[model samples]
Target: MRDGGETVTFDFAPMVDIVLLLLIFFFLTSSLGARQTALPLDLPRASSAVKESPALPIVSVDPAGKVYLNGEATPLTSLGARLRPLAQASGGVVGLRADENGQYGTVVEVMDVIRRAGGTRLALGTRLPAASGATP
Candidate 1:
């Protein structure tokens, strides 16, 4: 009867746990985003083009017929060496991007090199046409 009452305090263990969980979640997801490093080029338009998986290696060809592998300027003759390992790592899947104005023969030669380099699956990159009546 002599003592009145005592003060209470909040526990911070739950708050710390929630913060840790959020930190881990962001760290994991950040690495899963698209990591393409290919050079920027005006890709050909295709009605059937679809979104490609991010795991594949990208090879880009500019209008002047210069080939780039994963954003690095590479000679067409040496592409085989770089592509072989990439194809093996990605289960033979490789992404190809060629500028619309690029020479047709160059594109064909690149494809042939990719095939010889152990790439069994090929994905050509193209932009999808805008919907009709859409403003720029």
Candidate 2:
């Protein structure tokens, strides 16, 4: 052997464990926030929809006419009481994310509820269409 040097090995088990724990922690915590966009709703496409603040409260309407507050299912009757404080805090600005195929009447009713809940301004959620700068 021509003056060979000793080889050293690294034990990556602890680092890997820490990385896995961090990953799980982040995943669990991230889901705890307002997840209006987390739903599988097919949003209507728009040519001009800008990003808004995340702190703005969100009201979601699924295809089945069910209502949700920040990703948690809520009934229509109690939506006002629940949304009042958030609306006031956000200066009456609330975001609405409704499924594109959802009933129009239901969406309108939900909007009414949001308005009555002290939300003076509505920020409707929409996505850009596949065709660049095209409206859907």
Candidate 3:
């Protein structure tokens, strides 16, 4: 014997628990993205490679000819100003990352700007290709 006025209710506790679990899972699994500017460029391969030192500041040059300093896009004229403090703070070493498709002239220009900015030590970023049959 059921009353005509009776209403049914749905339980959302389980659903909320599942949702929270999924949120936690994703939060734990998601990578902390690289701390660098979004420079869409493929780096050139190298035969001799070395591990990157974390202490150095990075400069990126994208294929579109945009320059990034410490993961932020900055004007060429202001590059020296931007880098001067960093150079003094970091003792003058600035790492350079340039795309393979990017023009050499652009890289040179960026290097020139860095030099004028008082950057003394510069390191070019590179990745070692898969080992070929040829011996080193």
Best by TM-score: 1
Over 1-136, each residue of candidate 3 has an lDDT whose tens digit, in order, gives 2488767788999999999999988877664533555567698777776766666777888888888887898887788888888777678888899998887888899999888887899988886666663532
Q: How well does model 3 score by local distance difference test?
A: 0.80
Identify the leading candidate in terms of lDDT.
Answer: 2
Q: After superposition, how far is residue 118 of candidate 2 from its true place, in Å?
A: 0.4
Model 1, range 71-122, lDDT digits (tens) per residue? 7899999999988998999999999999988888999999999999998988
Q: What lDDT score belongs to each candidate, Candidate 1 first?
A: 0.87, 0.88, 0.80
Off by over 4 Å in 1: 1-10, 14-18, 21-25, 28-34, 131-136
Give the residue spans of candidate 2 off by over 4 A.
1-37, 129-136
Q: Candidate 1 deviates by what RMSD?
A: 4.3
Estimate the TM-score of every prediction: 0.76, 0.70, 0.65
Model 1 poorest 10 in a row by lDDT: 1-10
Error of 3 at 133 (Å): 7.9
